[model samples]
Target: MKYLLDTNVCVDYLSGRYPAVTRRLQAAAPDDLRVSSVAVAELRYGAEKSVHKQRNHERLDVFLREVACVDFDRDAASAYGRIRAALEAKGAVVGPYDLQIAGHAVSLGLVLVTGNVREFRRAKRLKVENWRRG
Candidate 1:
């Protein structure tokens, strides 16, 4: 199954904080792994603000080389609109970037690999898996 990795999962994989997440990523086919453009933006923002900016940027570059980056296009926009409205109606809205990532994954029918299951589970029909759970 194709997987869209959330920013927190990427961070865990990159920093080696979660060995199980890293092992799962290593075991999966590189072609099956994807990152939303919104997640990439979040990664870049984190890297830009880090004390080890150059190192973090290099790490992100290497990670991006192995995983595909999917843009948040028109389809994702439509999904975002529906998801946002639904979550709002339920008073369970997630953060903007998280919403965008969820929308992108849902639009492409890809499973979302995240650490924030409770937050992501708020989006209707979003397939979420917590890689941190191993």
Candidate 2:
């Protein structure tokens, strides 16, 4: 199955904070993995604000080279609007970037790999998996 790596998952993988997440990523076929452009933006923002900005940026560069980055296009925008409206109607709110990543994943039909399962659960018809759990 195809998987979309969330920002948190990517952070854990890069920091080696979660061995299971790292292992799962290593074990998966390269073509089966993807990173949403929204997630990339989040990562870049984190890197830019880090104490070790240069080091973090270099690490992000290396990681980006290994995984494919998918753009959030018109279809993803439609998905985002639908997801946001549905969540608001239910009084369930997901973070702005998280919602964008969710929309990207849902638009492309990819399972979202994240550590924040409860937060992502707010999005309907979006499959979420926590690789940190092994």
**TM-score, every prediction:** 0.98, 0.98
Please report, in order, the local distance difference test score of every candidate based on alpha carbons: 0.94, 0.94
Cα lDDT of candidate 1 equals 0.94
Given candidate 2, what's the lDDT at residue 15? 100
Q: Report residue 30 deviation for candidate 2 (angstroms).
A: 0.5
Against the true structure, candidate 2 has what lDDT?
Answer: 0.94
lDDT of 2 by residue, 1-134 (tens): 99999999999999999999999999999999999999999999999999999999999999999999999999999999999999999988678889999999999999999999999988989999999897
- Cα miss at 70, model 1 (Å)? 0.8
Backbone Cα, N, C clashes tallied per candidate: 0, 0
**lDDT of candidate 1 at residue 104, scale 0 to 100:** 96
